[model samples]
Target: MENRIDFVNWLDPDMSIQILTCLDDLSDLLRVTCVSRCWRQYVIANGLCRQLCLRMFPQLSKVVHVVEQRYGTKDPAEVGSSNFMEWQNLEREHRAYAFLARGCTTFPIRDLISEPICASSTDNYPEESIDNTLEPRDVVAQRASYWSSKGNSNPAEPEMLLYKLMGDLCVITEVSIQPFEAYFQWGLPIYSAKAVRFRMGHPKSPVDVPLGESYKDYENKFIWTYTSQEFPMAQENRLQTFKLPEPVLCIGGFLLIELLGRVQRQDMDGLFYIWFAPSSLFNCSFLVFMVNCCELFQDQCASTLIEYFVILAIIFSHNVYVTDQL
Candidate 1:
């Protein structure tokens, strides 16, 4: 019988690349690299992951700025001397895209704050406290109550709620808010806001101040890193998610939700009640697994997860803002 080579070995580099390009799943690509030393080297050396990342998130093209800034002053001869550094850059891009994708898939929800502290408010109903918003949706013991602001019909005047994130940097994709509908009341009308705006930043001063103590003067104490365009909210009682135009990189770990417009009043008390759901931070285990297996290349997967894995959680006080009419 005539001797025949294995299918993968028989294929030329170009043909191999063409076949690998058909794989859309990152997991499949990772597995393919493990098939052989030749395949692993081919995948990394050819920057297939970088190509895949670019295809997935075209915005990553902006990474050119990062590359230029990092290597701008390097000698041309040194830069061209070895492809190792180029491969490393591609690996970083690949890892970042993978992490982002993983985050989008698994929306691990958690309450950033156990109880939010009300900062500045026109009025506070003892029963309708700011802490009411943080209660779990399924809690059967407590009826659905919400954080309400005093009657203010002005669109320019807005109520604000501040939350502090204590975890590592989080790439926020969406924020959700629910309007409280008094079902037991005569008419089950929803108390919705005209619009909502978000701001994220780091506090200029230390945030160690006690919940309701020093936060009364928090407005001027923080520096905003990002401000989102106003998003119109629905007049519905159910949970509504407002997706950001693009994912925001929240570095400073403070989120400010600004409620715009007056509450649609049903009774003499012209107030708006917001049924806030606990904000969820996306956490994915696959990202950690991939980082350990693909990036570290160490058999010590257990240690890798312990060292690099981080879960997102928010820690803050029960502070509400009741703004006066502007």
Candidate 2:
């Protein structure tokens, strides 16, 4: 009589797969791998970790393949059988997917704007400056603050805001914007655009893009990695969120905001204006996870250096004593 229980043997393979697919947490999947040798093999061979990651974030499907970057590793050619090679491939997938899932689920949230680059046009130099948008509050120094575009007789003339992110690489997920309401004006119109679009990219050259200046083909300076769909903006004096279709891997760290159409007209000037506070970029950086590991490596290198120097000192001392005695 069989004393040990094996669920995989008792149930159909499809049933077993269905049961495992229900697991959503990476920790739980990891625990499943630890149950027994057979269990570990089953999980890895089926590529469950990769499947779980793809299920949670379909955006990751863009990753065509996973290539290991491990150094000080020998080529698998000398160590191989067909079965062993297959198992190695499965093992690599298991580790890669697990790390991807962890990063996607656990990155920290923070505002990623380094500085406001420029606005297409400014209505007032000091009072309605683009820099004021960086201040979170609408009021600064006891005065209502906002960045306003130059009024245009053509309502269709779009406006733009450009900003530099905190780092050279970023995974941007969302953006926050607030339309400026001119409380001081009659009817208290909120100067919100009809629609908004976002683009993420890097500069064409290292130092070609000039500050406080722009050219006719200003976009030529950037190589955009991601461009979001145009989302309708509400005409309200409140913070609005525009979440990306997928988390964008922004290589060049520059962000562009396009305000598509003008909604409100200034009664005194009979022209349309786009007014907004400085927007915030929400992102997670891969650099954060690797910092601790880099610190650990640095500490180990320091210890090794100390040990190496002590060994050299002892050898030198022994040689000097022998020479003097002779």
Candidate 3:
């Protein structure tokens, strides 16, 4: 017996809902909404869908697409450069969304991003200091002054402490009181030296008299600061906090761009690229795919229909709990 069927009527509410849920699980939570009005409403009405959208869709989208663009293998059958460019565009969007989804911290996140390598314990010294014999003779004999042409001929002459090899000039400033570690980077070593001048602290009007020498004898010197190419400290400036007022989307994109620059500079490793690339690519690919698909079927799918589907896709398949899935 042949089965009599009406295609439109066959799509019962329950069946439609089940199909959407399945789409949410399989393809994309956001994509499923594009299927139909009922699917859109069902995903929207469910709180689970919202959470999934937050956790999975935006963030994961950033990861997948970013990586696929720059490092994706070329395929003859694929669109190649065009898709790669498209991926880059989406990568920017994904990054912005991801950054917003997870609040980006400005406190030198890059430092934590890289793996720590063990080196000499320059900060903490052991109670039992190594004998002079353990240290290199050159370092041990180091004096407090820059070497001058006047030379070691006069024992009265002070020797330079930190020498920039290949140059005769040496610096000796009165900044730091005790021996302190200088944060050095890019071949420039920060010296913890005090300035030679002081600021006046006079309560005028002939009220406060002079206390021995005027306050002109000393100035507050800034030292003991580490210099990183990532975060540079301006002279005379102390630590301060700044707020980011950008939308979560814009900030996320900025962070991604920052990450890319660092990666290109070789400051970060391949693992970071691996971690971020996937999510970025995914977002780009999915968004672009949806946009293209909608445009292609515009004759049948109205713009509102496309939007509804996109929103539904975000809802049903969205997985908020899916963290670091890539």
Q: Choose the strongest candidate by lDDT.
A: 2
Residue 239 of model 2, lDDT score = 81
Q: After superposition, how far is residue 26 of candidate 2 from its true place, in Å?
A: 2.1
What order do you get sorting by TM-score, best first? 2, 1, 3
Q: How high is each candidate's TM-score?
A: 0.53, 0.65, 0.19
Q: lDDT of each model, Cα atoms only? A: 0.55, 0.69, 0.23
Error of 3 at 136 (Å): 26
User: For all the candidates, what are their Cα RMSDs to the real structure?
Assistant: 10.6, 12.3, 23.4
Q: How far out, in Å, is residue 320 in model 2?
A: 55
Q: What is candidate 2's lDDT per residue for 1-326, written digit by digit as tens?
A: 86986886688988988899999899999999999999998899899999997786553454555544333345454598988877887887787678656655666557667777777788877677767777767677888878888899998898887888765545677787888889998999999999999887666665445454432347666666577899999999888888887666554568899989999999998999998854433232222111011111223533432211100010121121100110
Model 1, 1-326: lDDT tens digits are 99867555788878877888888777787787788887776777676765665564443343331211122134333665367676665555555555544543344444443236453453455445555566554333565445555555554566777766543244566777777776767787766778988887666645564454324477887766678999998887677778887666554457777887755654665544443332222111111011111122332534333222222212223221111111
Model 3 residue 55 CA deviation (Å) reads: 7.0
Number of the predicted model whose TM-score against the real structure is largest = 2
lDDT of 3 at 49: 48
- Model 1: how large is the Cα RMSD against the reference? 10.6
lDDT per residue for candidate 3 within 223-257, as digits (tens), equals 11111122221222122121122112110110111
Could you arrange the candidates by lDDT from highest to lowest? 2, 1, 3
